[model samples]
Target: MPSFTLPRAFRAARITRTHKISAAVVASASCAATLALTAAPGNAETTAAQAPAGVKPVSANGLPLTAKDRADDGAKDRQVASSLTAGLKVTAVAKQGHTAKQAADRSADRKIIAAPKAAPNAAPKRYANNLDGWIRQSLAIMKSKGIPGSYQGLHRNIIRESGGNPNAVNNWDINAINGIPSKGLLQVIQPTFNQYRVAGTANKLTDPIANITAAANYAANRYGSIDNVNSAY
Candidate 1:
């Protein structure tokens, strides 16, 4: 093998190049180690702090989320869900209460509508079955039929004509001569009784209430009212 000595400057230059290449290789290995350390799970917080705005630090697998971070996010989600559930429950309860109140009000209204109304008038008044009873009943009927008469006036005329006898007959009177005799408590003839007979009373001329009502009706037409009659017609 032949030995040849290199120039001093070229040897120096080659040594410098070799040194530069080694330095570059060492620097690159150092940079790779630093990046590996930064991406480690323990340096997750540091990586996140150094990350750009709106960007998250990620590990080799995925986002560099710690257990506490996952726990905090889960807690926030649970809190929001719990709040929504509680709000729904409150709304449902309020709606149910309103519906119940409305139903109760409707029930009360129905009860009020269903309740019976008070009677407008009282029962019909009762009367005795005698002369005094007949006079009072006749007056009531006369008032209803618009025939005016007083109890005292009717009693006075009845006493004078038939002596208060309900079955009395006046066959001796001028009315009897014309084949229409005066009969009953008021001594009313058949023709006058038929002409002026009040409704809702007995049809017989001798009936006490019917006879009184009919005679009062006749007297009212001829003398304004039975109360004004002091003498026979």
Candidate 2:
């Protein structure tokens, strides 16, 4: 009366179709995974000059010698620096408990005292050899003080001014109309040097290192970075 269905073979054929579909799905997923792996970005590369993390870079205003070394050497010759007093001393001459007005008179008659006798033992502090070192020192100092990146104009300003030579000295430095007495790689004016306490030991100015150190320091304080020197007046 009714048509009868087939037994195991028909069901087996459907199972084969499902197995093929499952294999195709797995293959598609594997291909997608492969593409993703290929498209991924690579790691960043580091350079030779870059120091490993957490290290303080060198800073000495281009001084070939270290402050510690200077101190150590200075210890042997403390007597000499002490003896050679470039500074002046003032003595208050009080006449056996004088009155207030008498003290005032002494003040009016203030004497410019002379420095004491001192020995000249230490050699002058030396600056670096070339211009590159001078520039690097200036940049390093700026970097240390957390100067902003936009202030990079300083490096360029120095090139225009001193050609990056730390020992660069201007012939006219300040009052010299013919030229200005600018010293070191940055060609800082003598007046500027006096104001900034740029002079250190016997002769750090002519020294390229000292010049760079002082110049960058002055630039940072006055302009917030060398970039100001580079960009505007």
Candidate 3:
């Protein structure tokens, strides 16, 4: 019988080599698995990067959809945007129409309430600024205030003092020398005019009615009546 046996050193060396080879193979396989795991995320990122322009990527939690679903979603978005734009346009048009109608209504109301034109040959509503008008106005005021005077007396004084000129001013008289010139239709001085000034008459002595009223009042106070005065009164 023949017995076959290796040397102890050679056998130990062979066993050690086998163990190292096995360890190397296992380490290589584990490294390959790690590389595959790392490359999987990179491949997924590359796919995402290479996707079509303007196309929305699927969300992480969203379900996958076909091309028809994507097309329908895009159509719905466009339809909604178009509907909103149309609604805004219609609202603006309606607002403009309402504003125009309001303006038209206001114009029509103004026209409806417009004043009528004057008649062709109607008499004037105001009194003319003349001697007769002044006397009449003053007489009306005198009657209301219980002042005693007549149109004849006022006319007589106006003619005697300044010849019915309501704008008369006695600048060369003794009263003028005193720096208080007699003014207006009756040529009354400012002091006398102010002293005997009547209510409801113009404050200015140059005013025809004011002068007449004041002169009448002065005459009534001093001489008891303007009818008695005939000269330089």
Candidate 4:
């Protein structure tokens, strides 16, 4: 039997087919190696998922980190947590302080509301500047000083002594001869006036209120009361 040699085109086709099959086999082997590498325990994605919570498997430069890096990251996380806890405590304390201040303010407001209001000032009492006014005013003062005299007694004495004259002076009497003339509505002498002069009255001998009060005081001391003096005591 004689061996037949194939054409150049058929030979070239066969070589091309062989080359394609070898390429296919090589690609399949490369794919299988990639699949094995992906399933390995040292894979980046699998390692990252299997790592503990809050731990990063890779660094910022896209490289896998060591155990020291993970520990540093955990320490940073704890530091942040501590700072947050301190912030929360401070906020709570501030809220408590604010609530206490509000309560204090409310208490102060209640006190203000419950406090009594001040009464308005009343107008001052007034009196006329005449003889009747003077007698009434002197009577009020005498009552306060515990001196005893009635309006009728005072009026009768004034009519007899000086006829209601506030500036009367007894110049012809023995009291005048002694150089201590009796003066004023009640005819009181200088020494007696000075001794028995009521407080809050004018110092002048002829001053109506002063003279009346002083003479009435002297009458009360000597005769027990001005109402008992019907003569020139």
lDDT of 1 at 106: 92
Candidate 1 lDDT at 146 equals 83
Q: What's the TM-score of every candidate structure?
A: 0.49, 0.34, 0.45, 0.48
lDDT of 2 at 34: 43
lDDT of 1 by residue, 1-233 (tens): 99999999999999999999999976675566456556755544554565444444444565556677757766877899999999999999999999999999998888545677778897888899988998998888887888888989899999998999999999887888989899999899898888999888899999999999999999889999878888888
Using lDDT as the measure, name the better of candidate 1 and candidate 2: 1
Alpha-carbon error at 220 in model 2, in Å? 2.3
Scored by TM-score, the top model is 1
What lDDT does each candidate get?
0.84, 0.55, 0.79, 0.85
Q: Per-residue error at 223 for model 1, in Å?
A: 0.2
Worst 10 residues of 3 by lDDT: 51-60
Off by over 4 Å in 3: 1-126
Q: How close is candidate 4 to the true structure, as a TM-score?
A: 0.48
Ranking of candidates on lDDT, top first: 4, 1, 3, 2
- Which is better, 3 or 4, measured by lDDT? 4
Instruction: List the pairs of residues colliding in candidate 1.
Output: none
Better of 2 and 3 by TM-score: 3
Q: In model 1, where do residues sit more than 4 Å from their true spots?
A: 1-123
Off by over 4 Å in 2: 1-129, 145-152, 172-174, 178-180, 197-203, 231-233
lDDT of 3 by residue, 48-120 (tens): 4554442324434544445766677678778999999999999999999999999999988885567888898
